[model samples]
Target: MSDSNTTVFTNPSSFILLGIPGLEVAHIWISIPFCAMYAIAVLGNFTILLIVRMETSLHAPMYYFLCRLAVIDLVLSTVTLPKMLSIFWFNSREIDFSACFTQLYFIHCFTVIETGILVALAFDRYVAICNPLRYSTILTNRVVAKIGMAVLLRGSLLTLPRPFLETRWPYCRTNVIAHTYCEHIAVVKLACADIRFSSYYGLLVIFLVTGPDVSFITFSYIQILRAIFSLPTKDARLKTFGTCGSHLCVILAFYIPALFSIFTHQYGHNVPLHFHVITANMYLLLPPMLNPIIYGVRTKQIRDRLLHLLTHKGT
Candidate 1:
């Protein structure tokens, strides 16, 4: 990298985040829903973690993955919200360059982690459905530990360069981010320098990690569907449907907002800027709120456990 690339900016070192431009009058109003969303996300994910920890029967590979998902969702929700809440509730929008890049790094990390997690959860379902006899043997506690470590390593390694690359870019324009949070493309677009390299690499990272993970998960579900159709009994099919449906709901929630944000940001040139910004917020906040509800409502095991915990507490 050229020294010019890495040279400290003589201009303001801090950036102002314009939270929903032209919606200034509505920020306080907007924050009510945003605050509600964060509360639901945290309470929901935290309950998942607590149930998974408290219920002995829920310690299987599926629940283990669910537990990790809750952790990631909680972290993802946290990383952007505190700053965002400040912006919405207190009009505190300025963030130092280092803090902006740090937020970007963590947001990227959470994306990778969530993608890896969905893949893992899909694999867990595939094993349970297609090869029930061997599910326990294949995904032993040791194997689960190894998988957890691998996902963490993968998420951290692939995204670590993003902040450095973004930081080295020479910035000279108005130091204002369009959205509430520090996302890779959002930050990269602010640089006075060309960002083609950074943009392509961001796409490459998505392709290398998330694209493959989503593909494998989709393929796994296809095989699982085939296995389900071959089941001899209707109850067997319904039982499988309940499990797969909840997982698919989570997958859709996580991916749809993600794809919407990516497509609109890339190809939806005619799309309004606020639409993209709102979609970005949805991309970060929706899954954390929805994942627990989907599981809690659809999964018999979790619902039963919640009931059991509640009934005992009432007694």
Candidate 2:
């Protein structure tokens, strides 16, 4: 273990993140709202998961993907919010190097997995909309299960290297992380050794995991749009668009902030550290909160079922 006295300023064992300016003072003010958001996010996604599991009508491929999405949202939220809430309520902001890397690993892993699942979902929509006749045969339970497995495996493999690389570096100096949650790049920046290899590997993983997935999703949507436009009835087109609108909203909610965060981290780090911290929280917290709402409000079936489920318990 490296001691603080011997460590260079740049190669400290840990960093002291300044956190959001005034966050310490605002902790009380923000805790209630943050807790509310966390509760809503968990409950909303859990409700969707439960509904999908219990409702026989939702046994189709679409709902299967939705259930998987709910699981992802639950996990994504759990990984970040609990820690953040702890910090706010208890003022326990300190994290060790190993724990930080562990958190970073899962955060990146789940983020990539969700992206892959979204791609799979886009393809599912394309098949359902563009080739409705063969949809059932093409996206059967077995195939969906396989795709789910693949998504998990790919995400795990891609993100595994990040933590491994981080562990190999010696931490001799700072320990304070600026953000509430442990982020992979931020953790990497604290390493005492050279991180050129880590950065290169990170770039490669990003391209391999997210780049192609987004491209495939875009392609699937393009094909879906083409097929929708070719339909004879306007009602059919409108219905199809409506079905996909929720998913598109979710995809945008998840990816746009991610892309913006990437851009800012790469180019805008000089702007203001607080700006980056806010964006990081937005990236981590917003998707899980928004996903259930997008699906619930957009899909009448889900909305009606949720309502029934909520109301029927009292009777």
Whole-model lDDT values for every prediction? 0.87, 0.81
TM-score of each: 0.94, 0.92
Q: Looking at model 2, which ten-residue stretch has the lowest summed lDDT?
A: 1-10
Compose the digit string of candidate 2's lDDT tens values, residues 98-135.
66777788888888889988988898899989888999
- Tens digits of per-residue lDDT, candidate 1, 59-108, equal 99989989999999999899998899899888998898898988888888
Which runs in model 2 stand beyond 4 Å of their true positions? 1-18
Supply candidate 1's per-residue lDDT for 214. Answer: 77
Instruction: Identify the leading candidate in terms of TM-score.
Output: 1
Worst 10 residues of 1 by lDDT: 1-10
